[model samples]
Target: MPPETARLPLAHALALGALHGPAELVPVSSSAHVELIPRLLGWPSAALPADVRKAFAVALHAGTLAGLLVLVPLPSPGFAVVATAPAAAAGLLLEDPIERRLGGVRATAAGLVAGSALLVAADARGATGRGAAEAGPADALWLGAAQALALWPGLSRLGLTVAAARLRGFDRGAAFALGRQAGLPVVAGATGLKAWRLARRGVDPGLRAPFAAGAGAALAATLAAAPLRRVTSVWPPAAERVALAAVALAGLRRSPR
Candidate 1:
């Protein structure tokens, strides 16, 4: 922070954390919210550097990982290992290129629309019999493959993971648990990589404040989003599409020639 600002903006960090944690826990295109919400509030542009923004996102995710661990019980160690393999592999291969080239507002909007459709369809058509304990490596792989969709950004990792699990006949709780569990390894890996990159770029001392705020907010929100028993319908996420469209339109107007 500049000397003129004096105190660190804990409120902004908390607001971002509150926003990121729930959006992430519910898996509704948190990638969209992390960027869109900040840009919308002007929290991430001039006031915060790009690197700090990335750090804050990573920290918020780390916090969500903690909440998920507590809120959703993990599968067996072997079960989780095998299940996380596909997405971990995918992340190692594709993370950089996607971040470098595919991350843009339009791509995000398209992905959110497509992902929302998948979430609702999976919920509506799924048979909801098996529970999370019944989920095996094969099921993990299925959800892991779905997790790859998050590489595109604006596609909810939670959405695709839950959708795939639900479609695989897992019950709602099981689907949600497995979906979130499956994401842990991948998210952890991605966050670690981001932190490493930030370190190489010479980590800023200011990163700590945002990290603390985001982590705290994410921890609270993740716990809250769980056990809420959301009944999925088509219309709710439609509003998300509208929001994304508006964001895109705004981005177009703001883009420089």
Candidate 2:
């Protein structure tokens, strides 16, 4: 089948979308899950064109962003702009190249392991007391840099941002808050940009229903998982990333390619 014509079954779309919510809310890479899950399941969507997959991923992100907007308080405009600028610039300049070169399972597995290690180190060394409100220009810049680094597949935006915040000495609650707030603008901007491109190109008629189903599922799942925002430790998610990376590596080994 032509990659563009490959269908994403509604069941697959809904499953991925539902998984997207909590995966996005936590430190695990939601993009990794979206990509790897389909592959692992031997779903036809795994063979879709990269552009089509990306568009669907953007749709999921849009839903997640909508939920985040409701759950997370609006950040200060200055903080939002500064904290999001690095990633915005990076995405514009390097997103395609990075995706082309580093979007493979091997690279993603390496990124997962590396990012998990960083999270562990940061959490261990970080001291408690500072709140998200205490973030300054330097904090924004550092957080923005972390977000930029996350453009590499499996280097999760949420994980990196939280690690950056923790390294900056924020408490668990504060780090989580800072991570979520710092990420909101970036996600919104990326989703909007991609959605615009998808709109201009026009979605395939066959994809529209799946797209809508996925987006709705993501939005509902995110809202339902709002309570997970209170999670204090990053260790569990870090461990999960490592385990997932192992699974991906094992799968890669088993593949004839």
Candidate 3:
């Protein structure tokens, strides 16, 4: 059979292209989408190709960068810089070992289940209060450390950051915002690595594509706000996340290796 095409609807195309950045800033799973969309569409491969995945990451981060710029008009670029330092440091330190050996589907699934449980318990305990608060430099560093856990693929940076924030006594909105702010540069770095890998592989330069994709992702992030607001407003990201993890794990268990 010929390679199947994963056709994108205009909106979804634009959204997927645009939403990478902020969508991830929230407690949603962008990597899960990266892994799931191709499977759902029955495309040539189970996951998107490295090039496409890279493009998607760049696009989403672009949107996120845009959203952050728009949202924070003044006096926080320093905060963004500081917050990302730990994740960047941790990522560089762990890249070889994590990607070479520990990163796998089963591990990702287990991380998902565990992360989901954490979210559920924290939410049920009413740990994430309402509104934002001041996060210390230490908190930012710790949150960055928490984000490194997401390198395993199934672990979500947002989920982990939010969970960490809740544990640190940040109210819900504060934890979410802090997590988003901290994660922005991490995704940007991932996009840059993807670009570097693509360049090393002699792929054509995608200068225009990243911008277009970022815009698309921005739109998606905007649209996603409604559902996310409604869902997260209820707290306990654990319930839905656990259900999703269970389903993904069950499917993995049944799939032919």
Candidate 4:
């Protein structure tokens, strides 16, 4: 159930989980962690059964995602939660397809490039006079649509949400807060529903360990959020987005398989 649990060094396990958690929630892609970690650790493919690996990854997301939902300072958590619903629903429906063919190294690299470009563009626009206002339901719906794009492995969920918010006229802080808050319910609802279904089917519930990882990730995300905001403010939002996208894409390309 817990990956090939022959008692991997506890340090390795925790380190892996911790690193992935924070990195996943930022503008970076979580899938990149799943793809990169194994190679970095020289972990064998068989170390975790495929299903276990997937479940663990999802669980980790839940934890960090949940942490953000509960902890982040936002204008309206309720509105944020409401906005994220459609994207979450879309994620639930498309999970299977995303898992099967999200693509390999090449595709991931390409996605990073695309995502970076978008980030740079966002940064270029700058937060100067944007993202200050609260978003409306229509704006939230549009943001949700942007988030759906993040289902792609390399796309940054935060980036998409921010982009959508900006497009709808929210300033930087507001956009970031909106995106961060919106994801809260999606993580909780999906994780709870899946765990429930698994239990109903008589599957071991321990399979949900990644959720813990996600919580750790949420802490990590908080640490990063403020710094990231400051950095983005230094540039035009659109340009910053594009710059980040290129850098991430270059890293993806250079990473060893």
Candidate 5:
């Protein structure tokens, strides 16, 4: 197919970009939404080449990272490095295989369900005592492991890290802070790596406009939703994941396999 003809439409790109901000800022899996929303809506973008989809997703993440850099302060340098290392290594080694093997609707949906359960259970049991300033190496390791596990499409980086923080006995505020802090480095690293690869490969001229539009929309949406970072309750997002998962599973069952 001609590159121009194969590119995702501008409107779809903008819509997904807008969705990425809040979805990413919260515990919901932005990647799952990016993958499933177009398919659920029967948008042709869902059928675009995997490379195109992946590139667009990376662009969206780049925008989110930019917004986060403006809105959230970084954690201690040592803690941030420790918390980001495992996921960075995991992304280097396993990203391609995970995308190839588990990027399907079924696996994504399963991840959503599983992640929702973990979030709810962790929140229910977690004590509200420890603060972000008190986070130690053990907490960093736990958060790093959670971030690595989140490489699965539906296991959100924010969600899993928050759950990990909670399980480590951090309060909701601390957990939320830790999740955002831990996630920033990982997102920044991954976005930088993927952006470099995309640049080397050279994006099609025809698709550049859509990519720019999506990234701008994501940045705007993320800035607009900055207040949401203060929200520590995980119930709403957890429920949302379950509902989205159900929609995905139902759609999958009804589609021609």
Candidate 6:
């Protein structure tokens, strides 16, 4: 998804938000969905500035973070604080440079494939009582590091975290629970940081309508997630994400925006 050529209107903004809410919950990369939704829907090819795209993504994430709070039991507050460290550090210190270098459509598509592979591998492992029940400081550190991969566009934060947990012996539900808990802080931190930066620079009045529309769509999708995700096992992500990445990469032959 090269910078969108056309202004993202309220309807399109809501479309992107609807995609983000559930994709973030599943193994699919929410960022990848955002990157593709515009193009996939036949938006114009004009180069959308990166900052606008970034701002929209940040706002969408905030809406979903709010949704997570309602549907899941968070890890203890102390655990949430310490566990969020590595990804938070990576986002604050490394995300900009990474986005500069690897935020391209091709690069992001590759991330989608890479992340999808991880999900498929985790699925292949099947459910086993071999799952571990212990949560310790070491677990927090390890999971946090794994989640740092999410700073890269098209890398699914939920996908990587759940994959890490599943590999470490957490059952599917447990992995999902832990991943959600670990994710909240990172999402909150990044959203807050981006909001601060936007405020400091002063937001463009043009951006407000789309941002509000996107956030509202996300909130609605998130509220419906409980029933939606119950039937959304790991299989669809394992398969659908690869197809999505392939489609995205195929359409990405245009010169860099």
lDDT score, candidate 1, position 173: 74
Give the runs in model 2 whose Cα sits over 4 Å from its true position. 1-4
For model 2 the TM-score comes to: 0.97
lDDT of each: 0.71, 0.90, 0.60, 0.58, 0.89, 0.75
The per-residue C-alpha lDDT of model 4 at residue 101 equals 80
Q: Number of backbone collisions per candidate, in order? A: 0, 0, 11, 37, 0, 3
164, model 4: CA deviation in Å? 1.6
TM-score-best of 1 and 4: 1
Let me know the TM-score candidate 4 reaches against the reference structure: 0.72
> What is candidate 5's TM-score against the reference?
0.97
Question: Candidate 3 local accuracy as lDDT?
Answer: 0.60
What tens-digit string does per-residue lDDT give for candidate 6 at 1-257?
Answer: 23242377787788778878877678788887788757655663124677777777778988887887787666777667777888888877887699789977778888888888887688568454443347666767767887887777777888888887777777777777677778878777878888888778765677678888898889888887777556437777867878887777777655334
Off by over 4 Å in 5: 1-5
TM-scores of the candidates in the order shown: 0.83, 0.97, 0.73, 0.72, 0.97, 0.90
User: In model 2, where is the ten-residue run with the lowest total lDDT?
Assistant: 1-10
- Cα RMSD for predicted model 3: 4.5
Clashing pairs in 2: none
Estimate, for each residue in 1-257, the C-alpha lDDT of model 4 and write its tens digit. Answer: 45354333434445655665555345666565555555544565325555555555555565555545545555366566556777788888897887678755556555666776776576556344544454667877777777778877777676677666766666666776676666555555666776665455443444333345444654565455545533324134334334544554555557643
| After superposition, candidate 1 runs with Cα above 4 Å error | 1-8, 44-49, 199-201, 224-226, 229-238, 254-257
Clashing pairs in 5: none
Q: Supply the global lDDT for candidate 1.
A: 0.71
- Positional deviation of residue 153's Cα in model 4 after best superposition, in angstroms: 1.0
